[model samples]
Target: MLAFDISGSMLKIANDFLSTKASCNILLYQGDCTQLFPLRSNSLEGILSISVIQWLSEDSQIESFFKECYRCLQMNSTAVFQFYPNSPEHADQFVTVANTTGFHSYLIMDMPHKTPQ
Candidate 1:
C-alpha cells in the first residue's frame, strides 16, 4: 500500500500505526501528490486517498496527479478519493482530470431528509 500525505507528522503517525497494526506492507510518501511517484508504471492495484485531492491549488497539478495515478494503476484498477470540493466547478475539474487521464470517474452523493407523510 502507498499512503501519500503532505504533512510529515501525519505520515509519521500513519507509519507508526501501520507498523503496529497492519499485517501488509505500506510505503509512505510525504510531498506534493502531483509530483511523479517513485514507482513503476502500472504497478499499483488500487489507490485510496482521503480528503487530499482538494488541496491541489492548480489545474495543472490536479491533472498531473490524475495522470500519475493513471500511470501507476494497473488496467481495470480503481482509485477511491474522498474530496470535498468547494463548488460544482471544483468537482467537475476533478472529473475532467480523471477522464482525461483515462479513468472512468463517478461521483456518489448522499442526501438525507425527513419525509412527511
Candidate 2:
C-alpha cells in the first residue's frame, strides 16, 4: 500500500500506526498531491484520501492531482477521496475534473449530525 500526505509529520504518524497493525508493506511519502508521484504507471491498485482535495487553491492544481491519480492506477482501479466542498459549485468542479481525468466518480455524503440520536 502507498500513502501520500502533504505533512511529513502526518505521514510518520500514519506509518507508526500502520506498522503496529498492518501486515502488508506500506510506503509513505510526503509531498504535494498535485504533482506527479514517483510511482510507475499502472502500478497502484487504489488511492485514498481524507479531507485532502478541497484544499487545492487552483483549478489547475486539482486537475493535475486527478490526472496523476488516474495515471498511477491500474486498469479498473478505484480511488476514494473525502473532502468537504465549499459549495455546490465546488462539488461540481471536482466531478468535472474527475471525469476529464478518466475517473468514474461519485460523492458520498457523511452527515453525522443529521443521524438520529
Candidate 3:
C-alpha cells in the first residue's frame, strides 16, 4: 500500500510512476498533506516522502506535521523523507523540527542533483 500527496504537475508524475510499478493499493491526497489522517495505525512498514515538506514555511505547521507523522508510524518503522533545503540554516531547522517530534536524527546520505527547471 502507498500513500501519496499530489497536486499540479506532481499528480502527473505520480501517475507516471504508478503506471510502471507492480499493482498495489494507492491513496492520493489532493490537498495539503498536513491534513492527512493515517488509517490502520502500525500497519504501514515503509513510508517515503520526497521534496514535499520543504514547502511548509511556518514553525507551527511543521510542528503539527511532525506530531502527526509520529502518531501515524508504528514502532521500528522507518520514514525516508528527502527535501530540498532553502539553505544550510533551513536544513538545520528541519532537523530541529524532526528531532523535537521524536525522530532519532540521522543524516543518511546527501547527494547532488540539478534543480528541476
CA lDDT scores, all candidates in order: 0.86, 0.87, 0.74
Q: Please, what are the lDDT tens digits per residue for candidate 2 over residues 1-117? A: 777889989988997899898575878888898998898999989888788998996999999999998999999988998888888788889999999989998876666234677
Which regions in candidate 2 have their CA more than 4 angstroms from the true location?
A: 22-24, 112-117
In candidate 3, position 8 carries an lDDT of 53
Candidate 3 C-alpha error for residue 69, in Å: 1.4
Clashes of each: 0, 0, 0
Which residue pairs in candidate 3 have backbone atoms (N, alpha carbon, C) closer than 3 angstroms, thus clashing?
Answer: none
Cα lDDT tens digits, model 3, 1-117, are: 654564757767877888788975676556566765555656667668788779889988777777677777899988877888877778788789989998875655476446778
- Which RMSD values do the candidates have, in order? 3.5, 2.5, 3.6
Task: Give candidate 2's error at residue 57 in angstroms.
Answer: 2.0
Q: What tens-digit string does per-residue lDDT give for candidate 1 at 30-99?
A: 8878899888999999988889888997989998999999999999998997888888788888988889
Residue 32 in candidate 3, Cα distance off native in Å: 1.3
Ranking by TM-score: 1, 2, 3
Q: Select the stronger candidate by lDDT from 1 and 2.
A: 2
Better of 2 and 3 by lDDT: 2
Cα misplacement distance, residue 70 of candidate 2 (Å): 0.3
**What's the lDDT for candidate 2?**
0.87
lDDT of 2 at 21: 85
lDDT of 2 at 27: 80
